[model samples]
Target: MPDPQSLDECVSIQQWLQREHLPLASPRPPAAVHVSLYCVGKSARIPEGVIAAARQAGTAIEACQFELVFDHIITFLLPQDNAIVLAGNGGRELWQLHVQIAIEMHRLGADANLNPNFQPHTTLLYDKDVVPRIALRRPVVLAAREFVLLHNRRGQADYEELGRWPLHARG
Candidate 1:
């Protein structure tokens, strides 16, 4: 998850899109803005043991804080709706951290289906209308100081934070 300032910046971008008369769907709360690392499973299917394992996996990860630079806003076409997002490369450190987390999860007997082609992004809103990619005037840089494990119910806006772990400062 991003820091409070970054979350505010994301919300500001969403507000900008709304002002442009873009066909935006629901606006996500600032607290809900996040770059998803792994999806365990559905809310009902995820057992307490799995959650514990996930938490343990998080604790096992050894990584330094990194920055994520979102340079463009793009739309991903989905069957239900188009997801408008702030897209970024998220650099090598982020990828390494992601892989480390996945490795730890697997070691702890948890299913962390790591995707080879993972694109880091933060979804701003959803819409039926597709929009062309727009480069930001200034790239939004988010300091990824910490990561959280969340339990999000489908079709709901609220996110239940299961656990949080801080990335240590680089030496």
Candidate 2:
């Protein structure tokens, strides 16, 4: 997630969407906006080696602070799952981070359901059937010094920050 100010803005957007009768995945705004780099399921299945590798990779990167520009919303109307998300500006650093995380996961044998075509986005809602009508808002820049290893608390959407790795390390 980004700084408090940016997150507040995201909350406002969610509120607007909800009031307009757009199907929302949850009631709380704190759980709405976030940039998920990897979705490794089942913490029990996540090998210790993978976690080690992720930590090593995290330590290797000096560019920890992130500033992402988001402007548009995308809707996936697939049969199994449907979601609306705010797409990022295709930042190279962000993609590199995802690649590093994925590599570790694959090395540790936690590669199941690792999305190769991972696009960095903050999901606003996951609704079925109804195609939400949303316009392109002005670009919002979200900045954060750290990225979180968020684990699902009680299934999808509801999450708790498990581990946090700082970015922009000089070492």
Candidate 3:
């Protein structure tokens, strides 16, 4: 996880993972790297449709400046799609924020892979085996000041940053 404007953001995450002699992951170059408020899953062929949904979702999520704490390391049970991730510690507000985004997306007809048990996490690496979380680092806290809509084509490295809407709740 990283703060878009923080110089220490990427460096901090790298160092934390490096301490364990672990190799860092090379996820596709993000058009806009962010803590995902919602994942719309596989990219659809109809870009226009996706953009329209995002625009609608933006209206609903105009104010959601939530914080995320990447404190623990974990993995899914699968070996092939194994992943090492930094997860939040039961952040209710964050979940609500994610759910709101999802609800809005669904309202605009986006219901691809909506995992009911959404364990919010940022993947550190993907290995065949369950990379031991024996070396859990201190919490890395990040502000979800903004949420972005990114587009990648068939797992390509390049992504199109469709839009970015900041989170500044009303007083």
Candidate 4:
């Protein structure tokens, strides 16, 4: 089989489908890449003030216009539950950091369901089946300053920045 990590060649037929352009998908944004950080739960709604703060921070710090997208619904295990989302050998390390942030967010009382153990990911393409599992390292670096709140629609969750904080090298 072809190496999945290889950048020069297609890893498999599945990877090709993932890359193919889709009509229903949101067009990629120019500023920060859109990524899912945590699940805040149905009951835990983002306060309007928090959303305002994040919007201000995102534009002020990043120097770009920000908008929210209610595009996808995803799931991931948390470390608190003795379950972790690992990005396999070929998985991205950023994802690991996201999980850590989720745990921290949970500790801060954002919402039990949405806090720690957030499985970070972005909606690239839609699919009906469960996502393939991958290995990843723990305690990845993430910025606490940058976060958005999104509204839930059906099973799909939309994302919007709720607040922004600077991430130091230590975090």
Q: Rate the local accuracy (lDDT) of all candidates.
A: 0.85, 0.66, 0.61, 0.35
For candidate 1, write residues 47-150 as lDDT tens digits: 98888988998888888988899999888889987888999888998889878888888898888778798889998888888778989998899998988999
Give me candidate 1's TM-score against the actual structure. Answer: 0.92
Provide TM-scores for the models.
Answer: 0.92, 0.75, 0.74, 0.35
Order of all candidates by TM-score, from best down to worst? 1, 2, 3, 4
Span of 10 residues, lowest total lDDT, candidate 4? 1-10
**Each candidate: RMSD:** 1.6, 3.5, 3.4, 11.2
Off by more than 4 A, model 2: 21-28, 42-62, 78-81, 107-109, 112-114, 130-135, 155-157, 169-171
Clashes of 2: 4
Tens digit per residue, CA lDDT, model 4, 23-82:
233322222234454454544555755444434433433212222222222224333221
Give the best candidate by lDDT: 1
Considering summed lDDT, which 10 consecutive residues are worst modelled in model 3?
Answer: 25-34
| Candidate closest to the true structure, highest TM-score | 1
Alpha-carbon error at 133 in model 1, in Å? 1.1
